[model samples]
Target: MDVLIIDDDPTSVFLAKLLLSSTGLFDKLTTYQNPVDALSFIKVQLVDNQLPQVILLDINMPLIDGWQLLDALMPYQAQIQAKYWK
Candidate 1:
């Protein structure tokens, strides 16, 4: 599985990567401190191979908060949920 962690804090992102890695769940884990970059990644993901099985988003951030990100992802909700249903 692929995982995306969006957070401004380096320590939180690093800890999540460590814990998830220990579980042997993800093949690739990508972390983004900037929501703009993360949003760009998410947009490309819709056309790319596959979206992350899980996305860990922080509610707090400097630019483009998590809520905004969630709103941006709304259009892809159908596609996002479909993959996990199986």
Candidate 2:
């Protein structure tokens, strides 16, 4: 499994990684402090059919909060959800 974590706080990222790492559920774990960068990464991944199985987005970022990020992802929702259903 693969997991992606998006957060502006380094400490939160570290803790999330540490806890998730201990579970040994994912072979690949990716993190991005900047939601903008994360969105770009996700867009590329979506095109490449490499979207993460799980996304851990922080809902309380400075510039772009998780809710807004989700709104951005709305266009890709169909494709993104299809991965899980299959």
Candidate 3:
């Protein structure tokens, strides 16, 4: 499975990566400190068949928070849900 971590804190991101990596569950792990960048990456992934199976998002971010990210992803909700449902 692929995992995406979106958080502004480097320490948090590092710790999450360490913990998740230790589980040996994810085939791909991507981290982004900026929500905007994360959103952009997600958009690209949506069209590429490379979407993450799990998304660990931060509610507090500089530009786009978790809620905002969810809103931004609304247009693709069906696609995302279908991907996970499969």
Candidate 4:
């Protein structure tokens, strides 16, 4: 499985990666310190049919926070994208 984590905190992301890696639940873990960049990457992946089955996002960020991300993904609601927002 593939996992994507968007968090501004490096330590939180690192610890999450470590724990997830230890569980061996995912074949890959992609971390992004910037939510905007991460959202761009996610859109590309979705378009390319390579979207992750699991995504973890932080509510707090420098710019373009989680709520904004949810709004941006509203068009994909037919794909049930917002179900993963929490």
For all candidates in order, the CA lDDT equals: 0.89, 0.94, 0.94, 0.86
- Name the runs in model 2 displaced over 4 angstroms: none
Better of 1 and 2 by TM-score: 2
**Residue 17 C-alpha lDDT in model 1:** 86
User: What TM-score would each prediction reach against the true structure?
Assistant: 0.88, 0.93, 0.94, 0.88
Candidate 1 lDDT, 1-86, residue by residue in tens: 88999999999998998899899978899999999999999889877847787899998999889999999889988887776676
Candidate 1 collision pairs:
none
Q: Please write out the lDDT profile of model 3 over residues 1-86, one tens digit for every residue.
A: 89999999999999999999899999999999999999999999999978888999999999878999999999998998887786
Evaluated against the true structure, the overall lDDT of model 4 is 0.86
List ranges where model 4 is wrong by over 4 Å. Answer: 80-86
**What TM-score quantifies how close candidate 4 is to the native fold?**
0.88
State model 2's lDDT.
0.94
Q: In model 1, which regions exceed 4 Å deviation?
A: none
Comparing 2 and 4 on lDDT, the stronger one: 2
- With candidate 2 superimposed using the best TM-score fit, by how many Å does residue 78's alpha carbon deviate from the native? 1.6
- Model 4 lDDT per residue over 1-86, tens place: 99999999999999999889899999888999999999899888867778888889999898898889978978877655444444
